[model samples]
Target: MKTFIYKKYSPRPNILHLYEHVVSIHIHEQLRKMGYYCYVDYAIKAQTHDQGLATITIEVYNSMLETEWSDLLLWNFEITDALIQIAYYQFLAEEGVLFTVKNANLKEELEVEHSNGWQTTKNIDTPKDISGKDDTALVASSKDIPLLSYDIVLNFQKKEVAKESYHDALLTLGHNIQVHLSNKKGYYRSEFSVIGNEIKLSFQVIELLSNTLGQSDSLIATGVIEELIESEALDVFIDAKKARQLNAISISTFVA
Candidate 1:
């Protein structure tokens, strides 16, 4: 199998660490839904207290079914997009920006950001003070401040690749992965390469203090093997093998 390595460095190591944890869980859950088995061999976080930087190493395993490579790449793109959305949402939530459901009519009233690229809109309407105790007071003040909402969009650009720049293509892929993963982790340095069939991904984050969050194993095994065994063809194969053994025994008894 071929292998690819993607690395990144983050200055704000703690946030980056949390982002990786969230992405790892999300990607595994997504792959499982598509009938693919993914395993994390290891995720190690090395932090330098004096330097305030943390390095993370993550190794993932897959069955390497060639037929699913395209799907894998597409999902990789989706994973990047999802991470960006989640990071933006978390940021807004942290800033006390209340986000509501997407309203079609709000686009007409407010300046909606274009969907073609990464954009964030804040305070679609007036922010309301909803922390009132009296129901009458709340109702009276509701008209003074309206509920607020926000929109975030990120788009991926398509590029043609020449045979000479295959390595560059891998680098771009690695960058995309790192950008989404780095939003919370903080930015530092990163690298990406596709070596044989195996893909190795790693990153480093700088933290103010020390942490032990990334040292634990967070892999969950899938039941693809059991599912395959329960298929109709496998049942037929098992039945046929049993019948063949019985027939051979009967022939030997007659010969005796």
Candidate 2:
């Protein structure tokens, strides 16, 4: 398991509550993509003499076991990325909502650091004007929109299948099927020319995980197969490879 420590100092005490909520939601969303659920425990400490100064500490956890720092570093980086975006969005919102409070100047500073001594700090700034922008769209684009890519290979031992058959198989499976064919090595190749009609399909997982939360890689693969079956796409491919049937379908995911 990995741990991240977040500290914030807010001159306006009320902003701490809002900051806590934003950070918790953002962290939970990011961890959900990695098949882990998370919870936050936080506390606010009031300064003894200073009326408006308060310190907040938030602790975040997930289900991953302790592994090499190099492996865990990527996950930490993603969490950090989400924190930065959340801070920016919250700054914009606070600038609008907290403008009425007396001496309500929002001076917020956030510091997030991982266990490995990696740290980042952001000083929230008030936006000049957030008049007509959609907050939901801004947040969705920054965090919820998952841009993922993967390689899927469909193999069949059948001989002399048409090239167009490969195209039809993928189209029947899903929408916006991006197919890149090459005759060169170290690139995606189509068995349409080599043996039978085989296709190397590259596409996003969001389409496959549309019906389900993309918690695990296995879930994503199972969802794709289920969708294909429901659309009768798998049957079409099987009929095309009637001579020998499909040997295997392999998927390897790369999250970007």
Report the C-alpha lDDT of model 1 over 1-256, residue by residue, as the tens digit: 3233222233332233333433444444454445443222212232222122222232334334333433233124333444544443333323233333232332221111111112122212222322223222102211222212211111222223333333333333333333333343322223334452212334333221114213210110012223322322122223423212211000000000
TM-score of each: 0.26, 0.26
* Residue 23, candidate 2: C-alpha displacement in angstroms: 26
lDDT digits (tens) for residues 29-128 of candidate 2: 3433333321111111211112322222223332232231122322243334445444433333323232222332222222322222222224222333
lDDT of each: 0.29, 0.33
179: Cα error in model 2, Å: 14
Count clashing residue pairs per candidate. 15, 2
- Cα shift from native, residue 74, model 2 (Å): 38
Q: What are the runs in model 1 whose C-alpha is more than 4 Å off?
A: 39-67, 70-256
